[model samples]
Target: MQLADLRRYGASHTIIQSLRDIGIKDIYPPQLEALRLGLLSTKDSFVIASPTASGKTLIAEMAILKTIFEEVGKVIYLVPLRALAGEKYADFSRKYKPLGIKVGVATGDYDSRDPYLAAYNVIISTNEKMDSLLRHSSPWIHDITLVVADEIHLITDAHRGPTLEVVLARLRQTNPNIRVVALSATIRNVHDIARWLNARVLESTWRPVPLKEGIYFDKSILFDDGSHKEVEVATIYDPINIALSVLDEGGQALIFVNTRKSTESVAAQAAKEVGKRISDGERKVLEQASEEVLKALAEPTRICRRLGELVKYGVAFHHAGIHSRQRKIVEDFFRENRIKLLVATTTLAMGLNLPSRRVIIRDWWRYQPGYGMGPIPVMEIKQMGGRAGRPGYDDHGEAVLIAKSRRDQAFLFEKYVGGEPEQVISKLGTESALRSHILACVATFLAKSEGEILDFISYTFFAIHKDPTDILSIVREVLRFLIEEGMIKEEGGNLKATPFGTRVAQLYIDPLSAVIIRDALFKAEERDRDLTPFSFFHAISATPDMMVLRLRKRDYEKLTPHIVARKDEFLLPLPGEEDQEFLAQVKTALVFLEWIEETPEDKIVGGYHIGPGDMRALVELGEWLLYSSYEIGRVFKLRRAVKYLSPVRKRLAYGVKEELLELVALQGIGRVRGRNLFNAGYRTIRDLKKADIEALTKVPTIGKEMAKDIKRQVT
Candidate 1:
């Protein structure tokens, strides 16, 4: 259908005109198929399963825009990542908010309920954030008219799939008439997902930019269709040469490496080639972007220092290890073609809009300490390929996998390049996922009995193809555990959540974590011992909600002595460990101790051999776990423990000592400035309130303007 024809499907002339203004002259085949299937005519669900760059996002935008203008209800677009949420929110707000539709975004920051979100006509959110909203029972949720689930193929992901499942299930239950539009990459058995949603399936392999998938082995590209091309490259093992080849063809390239270190190493190596070819203007843009990255650090971390070096050469690496602000700078420069080559980990495949003309997969295997090295899923291989063909960039794109020899090339091509993706299955039936979900259902009153709970879960994609008997046994076991912990009471064959259980659900914490926290508090109160921050960190780390530090053999040897010294403080005994698994909590607690003691970010990263992202994630998770632990103390009536844990949460949050809590509570001050102020004799808010700007500016980390702002806050 042409852009003008969109007016026939509830689109106004203004909307059609705006599409044309943005260079969207016509709808693709998959979108036209969706329209023909009555996508805009009724309040129905749909699964638009199509190849990447097939205009699936456009189809979703059309449906949501029309619904918001024609209907008087809120619309939600759920994505799997915070980055995607931000991207979609910016896209929708720019296009539709000018049409008088309100748009807002919610990802996380758990302190605020964000009740103001009800004022918006459209809200973009992460799946986990939407789940937390549903658990909170947001009042506006009941009025939702449309929900767009982007990357619905994530149902195969073991860790996060179940959260998406529960969130979608609850969205439907909240409003039985709500329309769901699920967008997916090409996965096998799309019909299963369509059947689960009770929606019409619109599947297509059409792409605006066609893809050429092949294997790069022994200086030649072998295509699946019996086509072969001999390419000139500088070094057989140098991925940079392939990228340089693309640059010579007047196109960009993306290199997918196996690890974060490889991402930086490859980006740096490629920059040496690309740097020799960059224009002065391009070098200036790259310089500005590199400066933005360096500005993210008070004293640049190693990742920032390396990123700064590469960006100046029109090259960048993207991974979770870099800071978010630095990541955005890299993405912006790459999008504008200032950065010619980007080396990234698998994170770049998970729904970011940065696309390239050539995608080179440097590794097809990933290493996990628990599982060792294993081949990636064919679906992941395809997802990485999807990033090659942007909607409007190139006429065609190339995706090649690196192979050492003909034997490896033949095996990889047969297993991945020439094979179909695996079917998407439900991970909701897994014990860890189901335990929290089952408790959520009972606590939120979505289900009052075993039969009701199972029936509700039966709507999940897991129940569509698998045996219900398996989930039944698991559900029963989880129910027994909940009852044993007094989280739920069974009376007259009906399950009811206790007050503590209701609070736990309201807090959006795992019930198992809550139980763990409660037991620790109970033990402390029973023993009548004073608890320290060391013990508090250990207690919180024992819960699954926080990511524990991975201890190496040397770490185990060193921390065993640390744990032995603090034996009397812990509610549970800290065992000296030989492997990472046993004394993981002790190692995590050590990190927390270092954090509150004002350890520099670089020193923390160096000591742990972790990146900036790991330290940030650990601190954030510690805040949540500590907050939950404090609340758990209330459940057990441990007043003293509550008081102790409350301040520790702030200490963890700001990476500050206890004396700096008052200063960190304000908007702009953090550990650096807070410590400076504390040492300068302005130890608390009252001290700041009474101090002059000159006195405040004498503190090393505070400037005249910042000191005035700090002084003004109290006056």
Candidate 2:
């Protein structure tokens, strides 16, 4: 059905009537139907699982519109990414502004606590921001009548899944009657999710456009379900060749690659092949588009110059490293039919709303460290497949998977095309996650007594493990830690958060941060010099941004200079070492970094970057440690003494540390080398006494030549 017909159908519905009153006419059919049923149904919660490019967002918009019309309370539209939150905020503001529905976006890093947040009818935010607001007891959140989770299936993500689960549980507790609309792609455990949320499941395989799936192997098409024909893979390229066959078919094509490097490679190869076919005019436009794409992909003085060269021939790449604005620009060009082809990573699979006539998977397996090369999950491949078949442009869209061997081709055809997506599992009970979140609960007053906390945690799927005894043992250790920390005081058979507990809660730090801070404080007591809180914070927060010990291309070796420099300053040793104790610490740091970096940028719930979360947790732990260390500082009620303990807080907030500032002010020293010297123990001119030319060279990372330079600087 046409969009006009869908709008007309929506006109009769009460929710759509309200939306129309606000001047919204471009309602997609599936969205309109889902919205209408969501409003009319008795279910408090509902799940809308549809393919990518389908109007899943419109379903959310309709619910927000209905909530505004009913005047019950505020509406919370939760998205997976900060970029998505910004995009949705703009869209909602444009549609809802004239109707007097004030829209506000809270992504946490910017203007986190807006005073007018409560006044706004619609609040678009990342899930983490919402969690923070809930933890901080933001007044606006208590009145939320509708909660719309955009990527509900992400609860399976090990790093981020726990936060989403806890947030949902907390929201349910706060407002049992709240209307929840969970949107996802085709997931296997929709029923279980429905049961968990007590929501109705609305699952549909229908796409506004039809998708044709096939496998390409040995230059031949193994199968084409659309026409039930077996043609060569070269013939499958016929349509692409046809698009290039004439200059008039001006629209661009999007090719999905599994890796960032491959995106550039495929685009370059396609451009070379297509360059032989297209006219000068077409080539000019393609080259310009390709240039824009290359500039987006290039970074730090054109480090990937070879990759960028592909774009000169009218090919470009898209991936997370390109930056959000660049990705958006590419999407806009493709939408406007300005660019011809976009080679992108699996990230293109998750609901970016970009459509193309043909989607190709160049590689089915991606190499991961330790795990080696494994097959791409079927769900991700299917999501990319769904992106094929642009509505209105093509009668049928094509999704091609290029396989290497006969067995590989069979696996792709059977597992990706025919198999169901995996079930979304909970990662809540993992020892690390449980310990951290339980501390957060104690700090935030979510769980007061040991029994109360255990009871709440038992509601999680993590509690459903096969060994109940093992679970109880884990819970016991967590309780003991809390008791020893004095975060919880057992009084009259009930556990209450002490002042220390309340402070940690208000800070919204992870429990692990407290442990780290306590350890740092003990070490500091052994040494007479006061450890700069900011130094500690940066040390803890600096995740390895540039190490790829895993097998990568030879060119990746160029990154060694940058990686070694960061590792030296951060005091991070290279991966190969027999010292188990130091290795264990390095492993912990790596795990923390992985958690921080791997957290989906879109999934940061409450204005918290898992990186920043780790940092904030450390700051809170430092504060608690300071209170424990100097009772006089606590008694005098001196802010600066406590503040001085955690200098990293200011450094983190400003992105400039006092030591860095001091180093930058020095003559003949640049920021890069200044940081190097400072990390090497020359913090001030007085510390130069410790620096001898040869002795400085002997320092773990500093070489003899750098030691000579340090001696000259001291002189």
Query: Which candidate's lDDT is highest?
Result: 1
For all candidates in order, the CA lDDT equals: 0.82, 0.60
- Weakest ten-residue segment in model 2 by summed lDDT: 543-552
Candidate 2 stretches greater than 4 Å from native: 1-14, 21-38, 41-43, 110-114, 223-251, 274-300, 303-314, 367-372, 458-470, 498-509, 521-538, 541-715
Model 2 TM-score, all chains together: 0.73
Model 1 spans > 4 angstroms off: 7-23, 109-113, 225-227, 527-530, 690-701
Most TM-score-accurate candidate: 1
Q: lDDT tens digits, residues 113-174, model 2?
A: 45678888888888777777776677777789889988888888776688777777778766
* lDDT by residue for model 1 (392-491), tens: 6688888989899889998988988889999998888867888778877887789999998888887778878986666788899989988998889998
